[model samples]
Target: MARLGAGGMGEVFLARTASGRPLALKTVHRDLSREPGFAERFAREIRTNDRVRSPWTVSVVDFSPPDTAPQWLATEYVAAPSLADWVHRHGPLPEPAVRCLARELSAALVSVRAAGVVHRDIKPGNVLLGAERPYLIDFGIARAVRDPRRTRTGTVMGTPGYLAPEQATGAVAAAPADVFSLAAVLVYAATGRSPFVARGEEPDLPALLYRIVHDEPLLDGVPDALLPLVGECLAKNPEQRPTAEEVRARLETAGEQEWHRVVPPALVAAAGSREAELRGLLAAAQPPVYAPVAAPPAPLTPPVPPATAPGTPRPAEDLVAAPSRTRKAVLAALAVALVAFVIVMIVPFGGGDGDGDGDGDGKDGTAPAGTPAPSPSGQSPAVTSLPAAWVGTWTGLGPGTPDADGVARARTQDFAVTVTLHAGAVGDVMGAQVSNLKEIGTGRNLGCTEALELRQMRGNTAVLAAVTSHPTDRSAAIDCPRGNLYLVTMTEPDRLTLESEGAQSAGAPAFLTRGR
Candidate 1:
């Protein structure tokens, strides 16, 4: 069982099928089952509900009345928490998600109306959030357009915040009644508060109903694009409201802009940074280390300008340095010319002896006295390869459960490859497999260990074999897929290159490089 909730009519439990498919089962309250006419109404509602077939409508799978105990109805269980639960914890939803909810629920009502049914109740409690979608629930209160049960005297239905004016007045409702309820639900999702507020000692419910029928909603904070649509939904005359299909189209168009407008720039920057970091980490073949470099000395500050009354003579040191500068320039030029002459003299013998000697001496090519050797260009040493100790299996980030063996088994069955790593290896296994492997596990075989066999190791490339170990495993020769395995080779301490085949195959050679 995954979830449990209740409506005015019954309790709902969400469970999974044998194949792990989810389902929602609703059981009528024992007291309600015993009430006269409840069974007939429930059965009729179920029949009407079974006809709805919109993406937004909750699908009915099975339903049964009490033969010996409480009656129950089963539906396709959506795989997400409810909107009410989401609101309680996350406060109001973003404007886009709220608009999406409103549009989808309205479309669902249109489908129900096409089936000649009216969902007398449309509230947050009855909406289930599915991953990437929404599901409308609690159709047991639905009634056919001409159903006489809707005329029942002194019976008020629907939650206080969502009930339409006609619903409160006992007037037979059409599709617009649900539209009004949908608007209320949207208001709740958008603002975390209902449009109609209950005030004073004995809140005047009649005045609130009157306002809903005649007045415009106080639209603070509501998106301008959605305000007009919401106003149409809350129209006093049922004929004035647009059909659910129109609302769906309008909201879908509005949602794209709202989503873009609300996403924070910081989140976008963080995503970009993470992608860059991951790519760098995955491609690096060698471990990285940092060494501090010496800082350059600051330049000498220039002398400040001297204060002068009209036209004063400069200081003696500044005046004396003028001739000294010309003399120093002449001396520097002479030194450069001497250096050029020496280089020209040595050029006949290939600039210098191969053994670094500048003199013409034959004995070990020694340099002349008082000559200093030039320093080699300064550069950090390159990382050539990963540490030998790092060659072993490693785990990835996810829920830690079912043990390593269990995860391996599941992967072998679904993905057709046994996934393994060396003790400290960073990526998936390489090489040939003895048998096909699965990517996901079933109940009985929840193992996660992968056996990797080291095949060959070249300068920057290593070949490995991925072997599957299962009682029912079968072996076969398969073509290598491109980009399947990456050989990460470290050329220097800070440089790692990834080499792989450009295209992936079931079995293919992979390559890596230190640079483009």
Candidate 2:
């Protein structure tokens, strides 16, 4: 196990299960865990976590019982860089990717609202740029919206500059506050500067709060396409801002193609390489030892199928018969082989039902698939639906349209999309698209890849969250606007139709055929 980092309440470690799948194990500080009412608070957070079921957020795998010493919580570890880290190293994201980020984050907020929760923090640091999609992480400060026990008067939570005006003013964050912060984040992604602060300037906390309440966001560098929405989000009146659902609806024009335009190739390569490296390490790591079980005594090794060789007795048969050095060697070999297989194939990193890799049943004391895994407080996991019959590649084309500027000088381009579905649960899809048209003036080609996750299914139609985009042809790919949802329907045995839900210019569903 590797120590990832530490936080105010606990220390986080990257540990592999007996099966070698990686997980983020967060152990609460012993002093904090023993404090009065801390157990109830921790348990409540676990219950709150179970209610938020979005493809954009990480899921809890298992946790220690609340009453136990050294209480801990385990969640699926996302092998991706945070939005804050990426922007700081690579600079601000292009307009298209920022738009995509907006849509994805809005969808996350939608799920949070559905669960009657409000994420008090929605800054870039909390967003992980996964290979397929962005994941919202670290929900430590989230609170129930309707719960009467809200923040104490005069107490404010959230980061400076990114906080909504009301949140900075000591008001309890609501769904709309999340929207406000979402816009602020978009501003930073587009300009590498906070909406309320000038470039290269870091004001004191109180001063930043005053500006949030009194000043208009500095949107000088934001794209024209996103200017209005970002301005509206920064509005002093929280009621004036769009709801998370509405924000998602408004960004429908920013489809998978737009996402491909803004992501840097270096970022994409790094994410993929990091994931491969982690898997390699897992395969090489030794199995973790376990303490002796009480009384009945657990099996010395994991179970394996009977051997198929003719006239060869199974390991179980040998165990029942006698104690021989040769038999013991054979049993030990089988045990070692079984452990490797589980690590290499059966168990996946971040054990959860949504990963679309395995059935999350807690066979070896791990949490069951799809539900909240048991927390330290003894909370059981919940059950959710998995994807069925939507696990294949589908391709289609959108008719050529004028460039984003809508100027007469802009060139028209047709967009082609290849949507690949995996057999996990929702939000387990990848898509790549290329433009038939060249750059407005230059003859260079354009293309990009995006991460999509299943949102819901209505009969033969699957609604997916367009999580994030990655650029394939960095120079030629142009930034596109944001849209959060896509509806795909199996029109025939070999045909599918995809439409961006709530897109104003969405004319007709694009017809797609099964791809090789």
| Top-TM-score candidate index | 2
Model 2 alpha-carbon miss at residue 213, Å: 1.4
In the range 1-516, model 2's lDDT, one tens digit per residue, is: 344544444455566643345776666556666677777676556645645667898766556653576666677777777776678778988777877888777788888887677777777667777777777765643331112212334755666778898888888777788889889888988898789899988786677788999988899889888899888888899889988888888877734553334577776777776677567556544443221111111211221223344554555445433433434454344333222111111111122111122212223222222222111211112113333445577777765444343331234466566777766554455443322444445555444455776665433445666576545566554544233456565655567766553222211225888787
Query: TM-scores of the models, in the given order?
Result: 0.45, 0.56
* Residue-wise C-alpha lDDT for candidate 1, range 358-400, written one tens digit per residue: 1112222122222222112111233233335233322112222
In lDDT terms, which candidate is top?
A: 2
Candidate 1: segments with Cα more than 4 A from true spot: 1-7, 65-68, 142-153, 198-216, 252-516
Tell me how far the alpha carbon of residue 511 in candidate 1 is from the true structure, in angstroms, after superposition.
Answer: 63
Candidate 2 Cα misplacement greater than 4 A, ranges = 140-153, 254-261, 294-516
- Could you report the Cα RMSD, in angstroms, for every candidate shown? 30.4, 18.9
